[model samples]
Target: MKLFFRLAKYLTPYNNYVIGAAISMLIFSLCNIAMIPLIARLSEAIAQKSIFQLNLVVAMAVGIYFLRGAATYGQGYLISFASQRMLFDLRTQLFEHLNKLSFDFFQKWRTGDLISRSTNDIDNIQNGISSTVIQLLPNMLTLLGAICYLFYLNWKLSLLTLMIIPLLSLIINKFGKEMHKVSSDAQKKTSDISSILQEKVAGVQVVKSFAMEKHEIKKFKEESEKSFWLSLKQVQINVTQTPLLAFIQVLGMVAIIWYGGYQVVTGKLNPADLIAFFAGIALIADPVSRLGDTNAIVQRSLASAERIFEIIDLEPTVQDAVNAHDIEIKGEVRFNSVSFKYQEELPLVLEKVDLKANPGEIVALVGRSGAGKTTLVNLIPRFYDATEGEILIDNIPIRDSKLHSLRSQMGIVSQETILFSGTIKENIAYGKIGSSDEEIKQAAIAANAHNFIIELEDGYETVVGERGASLSGGQKQRVAIARALLRNPRILILDEATSALDTESERLVQEAMDKLMQGRTTFVIAHRLSTVQHADKIIVLDRGKIVEQGKHDELLSKSGIYKMLYEMQFKEPA
Candidate 1:
């Protein structure tokens, strides 16, 4: 009930439509009650064999039904319009909230699960809302009106009929609890199925290469079978409740008829009033049955709402401070005893990492995998805040600056380049949206990408397939560089950008990278020793700590860890 009300708050903004729907429903219910008196009059007219009275009652019934039909149409249309608008706002709000979350939030959640929450779970909520408002509310109103009419006909019989209310309530409450638990489990299983589909689809090439197609299909079927059983269980619960409630209502109706007939024969109730009383009972029966179905829908919706609110209620671990403001950077970066761990239970990925890079200097990081090279660069962008210590850019604490302001002044080109599905021109301009064509072309030229882009069949307008599948490895790298060049940041991070390219492609990309590094504070995470040989400073890391730092030649002369790494990489064949 509390969750239902929480979901109802979304309807506040569309209250006018809700009010319209409510008024129409009220009229519809009133019309239903009005029919009871007409049923009494029709019975009296038939017993008297009065033709004129019968004709009048028949005409009034047609008029009342016409008005009821109009009310039904208005309620359906208005409520549907309001509900759809609410869904639109809710979906948009969820998407925007997702954008505000920190990097760790994405790391902690599965892509498929998040997708399910945004799409399938929200759809469930929609169904719940529509069912609660459209079916449940009207049925409840009709039931209430019918009960009042039944009491007006004979208070004693109405009281007797009401005896079953407690039993019905108990049944609804018991089955509703079961439905909620089953629905929650079903939603989770659905998320698991979505996760498997997303993971397998995204890694189709790997699966095919490993000849694991049969294995993946088997896994998918196992999940599907679980989902199928859960769905069947929910149906079993729903179907069981409907029949049980219907049987109880049928028992009540039988008692009402037997007692009401006794009253008629004893002259305690008129034939017309007895007829009207049965009509009222019939009206309430249908509403009660439909309400049972609505209960199941509401329970399922609440389950979905719980999952959605779990995400909506999360406070981002990283957000702009109250006084944080934007600042233009000049590329002077300082790391003062900075340390970080992904989570409280995890070991530190970076520790006591004090470093400085003056404007226009190139600092290269070299280490084995898992040595914290990427973690060090990631810190500069504030992807994750340091667990301890402070980082400064342009002499200002980065925590005091807005995230967009700090990151906008930096560019990153990684070994695995990511390009969205879009035109070459659009992808290049993505670094700086609304950029003029001339600016995009200039950036591409600077990155050595303009020639290849033009040589393509559609020139700049050619759509790059998903993740730039249509482009070659070197082509994608150059396009990524062009995007960075367009941003024209004061600070740059290049994570072995040319490592995957062939010799000729590497030379072209390296030349473009050199141009990108000029007059910018650059951090390079290198695998090949030859690439970073000319760096202004070389930092060697081991186990999350900087073991050595100096100019490349100076570190080589010292014969420390840097020299050892250099010797190992450039060593001759044994």
Candidate 2:
């Protein structure tokens, strides 16, 4: 109950519409109930051929029908307006919160699962709020009002009606709890099925290469069957809810007929009033039964609300500290005795590692995988805070500075090139928003990407596909480089940026890189040692420790880890 109210607050800004809808429906309910006695009197008047003309009664009936129609329309419009507004705000808030979550959150959740919550779950809630929730209010209110009017006409009949209606709520409340559990499970199963389907579609190439089509089909069939049964069970239970409520409604009518028939024989009730009472009760019963049937829709929406709230409630893993100052970087980075682990109680990725990146210098980290080269560079701009020790920019600890200002001074290009669906110019300008077109062109030229851009029919206006799949590996890498160059930051990070390219592509990329790195402080992580041979200093890492650091020739002359690695590579037969 509280959860329902909590979710309802999303629509509070549209309270005026909600109130209007309720008022209109209330008027409609009263009008429908009022017609009972009037219809009864009209029947008597017709039979008796009284002094009163028939035209007055017929006009009132016509007027009541018109007013009821108008009120129902008002109710529908107001409820729909409020529900749509609520849905828009809910989706917008959820999306905005997702943006605030750290990268780790996205690393753990699937694309398909998030899509389900944003689209499917929201749809369920919209229907619940607009139709089911509002419809329930009118149905219940009309029932109460009709019962009260029935008793006012005659208490003996009304008492029987009151007894019958409580059973409906009791049965619904009892089964509805179990129904919610089943419905929630069914929704989760549906999401699982969606995930499996999404994966198969996305990885059709892998399935074909491995010849696992038969296995995938069998797995999906099994999952689909499980979902099918749960849905069937839910619907079966839902089908029973209304008939049982209808049975109770019939009992009330039976009680009224028996008691009212006795009153007519005893001269305690008039025939016209008895007829009016039955008409009003019958009108109220149908919406009541349908409202009970709407239980399934309401329960399903509650399930969706829980899932959406789970994401919206998650506290961000990373946020700026209070009173944090803007980062004042002069391109001097120092990692002082820094130790880091992704999780507590786990061994450190970098153990008390220390290094300094001076202004206008390129520092290269070279090692085998798991040597923590990438992790070491990641700590410089505080992508993740060190578990121990301190990372400082311009000699001030990173934790004391605002994260946005700290990250603003550095640019990173990873091994994977991610270009969204946009034109080349828009993609480049994303590095520094509002960057001029001339600046964008110059950045592309500096990265050696301008010639390839102009080669396409649209040049800078060419729309890149998702993850830049439309472009060659070299082309995507250069576009990424061009994006970074457009930023013109105080610090730059190249995390194996040229690792995936062929020799020719690597040559072109390295040449473009040399132009970009003329004066900026840079950190380069590479497995191919030749790419970083001209670096001002090369630091060779082994098991998270800096084993060696010097110029290429100097390190080779030491006969240490760096010397051994280079010598072994040359001696190996191709």
Candidate 3:
């Protein structure tokens, strides 16, 4: 009964179905308990009477069993269906909320950790939904019904057994908190270890080049040891709870036997009634043991729910305004008096610098690494919000526009071209899902990628390896270009798009870009000055401040940083 599982609100919408399922489960519990009295009667009859009466009792028991089985099935199916549907809806809800979260959330989290929460953590919650809530409720009802009947059979014996119930409850409740703490600690360490392993594996080449195999292994050993100790402690606690509870159960059973024996000796209780009391004790013991075990499961589930719910309950930083209306954009982007720092206390990465790219102008941003070139262009797409100042797309402040509508008009190609594991056609079509095959091919051709694509055995059907490792650096860039081309956006941002390739590849990318930039408003970030020499406007940044802004020739004549950079690059030997 967490806020999230308050499916009372959700079920209210499906109240009729929920009510029917609950009623069916209650009826099943009732029927199951009803069999206990009939069982005691049959046992007593057999104890007193001969085989002549046994046939009728046996037939009645068989019929009752079959009817109970049918009711149980209905109860199980309805509860399982509702629980799974609730989990499905919860997953969708979490993912939807995640889609709204700001870039800072992703920046601070490890991909592997988030993935584990959505998969493994959510799965734990699902188990709680399926078995814990749905099944526990029914079992408790059955146990309660059985206790009532036992009380009716012999009130003194019922009181004796019931006296031990409070002790069992206290024991489990105490142990449950301990299990939750240990389990949560263990699970967090496990997620951290997984993320570390993933990072090491993904960057194996870097690890190898740095010869940090032993170092990495040592780090893993430390984390693995921590995880081991935590997990072992968690399991130890869980394993002891049950046996200790069972030992206490044996004491309860001994008390029942001793008290009942004295009563029978005094003729206070009949032999059949004493036996039936124990039988009822056996019935109570099963549910009691199961409920105790379920407490452990609930502890683990609550721990998992904390992780899963973290993402689900996260507040998105960059959500669209509630009263804002979607605007039809013409891609006239402007950054006015913008200043941004990753963390508020950190130094500003971009200062109060005004910049703009009028529709169809190819603006170039050139700077050394960490000069905040990427950070500047990233604002146009609202990937990260500016700490101070307005980013306007077609004169509308980005905070006031619909997120999807604003993003749809923009396309980005980064320095490292990322390709999906799919056919070449599929990769290009990723730029615009549902684009026709002909459209995809044309986009590839526009990016100077069509010839090589067709040269492959299956043409557009040729499968690209993971991360497009099968393709050459140049081919990957062209494919990325084709992807952006297919987007057919009003604004195109290329961050060192051709930096990964050879001269031949660069030439091909440049030619494709010429076509790509014909009418599109494009922002280019390049360290190689020769690449941006022909840009309509070149903005040069030193530190977080813009030092120069003009066409190439104008800046070159000024004999400043741009002139110095151009001469250094253009004068180099080929």
Candidate 4:
């Protein structure tokens, strides 16, 4: 019930449509009740054998039914309008909230589960509001009006009909709890199926390389079977409920008919009134049965709502501070006693790190894998805040600066280049939106990409497939460099940016990178020792601690970790 109220607030903006729907529903219910009394009039007219009276009853019936049809149409149209508008607004709000969430929040959730919540779960809530809530209002009104008319016709018979209410309520309440439990499980199984599909589709190449197509097919079938069984269970529950409810209502109807007939034969009630009472009972039964179905729908909707709100209620781990403000950077970055761990209980990935990079200087980080080199550079961009100590940019603590302001002044090019599905020009301009065509061409030329781009069939208009699958690894890397150059950032970080390229591609990319590094504070993480031999400062790390820092010659004279790594890489073939 609480969740329902929370979801209802989204409908407030469309209250006018809801109100219009309700008004139409009320009129529709009244028309149904008005027919009951007319049923009695028709019975009297037939017994009297008068043509004028019969004609009058028939005319009134036609008019009432015509009005009922109009009301039904109005309610259906207005309710649909309100529900669709609400769906659009709610889905947009969810997407915007997702964008505000921190990186770690994404780490904790699977892509398919989040996608299910955003799409299927939201659809459930919309159906609950439109079909269940909208129909519930008219059904309740019709049931109530019909019962009142039954009492007016014969109070004794009305009390007998009301006897089944308590039993019916108990049955619905019991079944509703079971429905909710099953529905929650069913939704989870559906999410699992979605996860399997998403994972397999994205890794199709990996599956094919390992000759695991049959294995993947078997895995997908297992999840599909689980979902199928759960769906079947839900069907079983629904079928049982409708029949059980109908049987109970039938028992009540039998008793009412027997007692009403006895009264008519005893001269205690008129035949026409008894006939009208029966009509009222029939009208009430329809709403009662429909309300039972609505209860089941409400339970299923609540299950879906719970999943959606689970995400909506979370607070992002990273957000702007109260006094954080934007600042233009000059790229003098410093880390003082900085330490970081992904989580509180986990061992630290970086520990007591201290380093400084002056403007326009190149600093290189070298070490074995997991030596905290990448983690150290990651702190400079505030991807994850340090678990201890502070970092400063240009003498101002980075924590004091707005995230957008801090990150916008830095550019990154990683080994695995990621490009969205779009044209070549659009992907290049993504680094700086709304950039002019001339600026794009200049950046591409500087990165050695303009020549190949022009040779393509569509030149700048050539479409890059998903993740730039249409381009070679070196080509993608050059495009990435071009994008970074276009930004002209004050700080640059390159993580193995040229490590994957062939010799010729490496020479071209390294040349472009040299042009990009001009007058910007640069941090390069490279495993190839020869590339960083001339760096202004080479920092060697081992097990989350900096082991050495100096120019290439100075580090060699020390005969330390850097010297050993260089000898191993440049060692003669055995």
What is the C-alpha local distance difference test score of each model?
0.92, 0.85, 0.83, 0.89
Q: Which stretches of candidate 3 lie over 4 Å from their true place?
A: 1-21, 572-574
Backbone clashes in model 3, listed as residue pairs: none
TM-score (all chains, Cα) for each model: 0.97, 0.94, 0.95, 0.95
Stronger candidate by lDDT (2 vs 4): 4
lDDT of 4 by residue, 484-537 (tens): 999999999989888888999998888888999999999999998888887889
lDDT of prediction 1: 0.92
What does candidate 2 score on TM?
0.94
Q: Any runs in candidate 1 off by more than 4 Å, and if so which?
A: none
Give the Cα-based TM-score of candidate 4 against the true structure.
Answer: 0.95
- For 1-574, candidate 2 gives per-residue lDDT tens digits of 8779988898899999989998898988888887887888787988889746477788888999899899899999998998898999999999999987876688778767787888888998987786575687777777778878888888878777777657777988876886788888887887888788888887898999999999999999999999999999898888877678778778777877888899999999988888888887787777777766677788888898898999999977777788799966788888899888877877888988888889989999988789999989888777777888998888888888988898887888889888988898899998899998899999999999999999999999999876676789899888988998998888999999998999989988888888878788999998787788899989999888888898999998897888777776667686
Angstrom error of the Cα, residue 531, model 3: value is 1.1
Count of clashing pairs, candidate 1: 0
Instruction: Enumerate clash totals for all models, in the order shown.
Output: 0, 0, 0, 0
How big is the RMSD of model 4?
1.9
lDDT, residue 374, model 4: 78
Candidate 2 deviant stretches above 4 angstroms:
50-53, 572-574
Ranking by lDDT: 1, 4, 2, 3
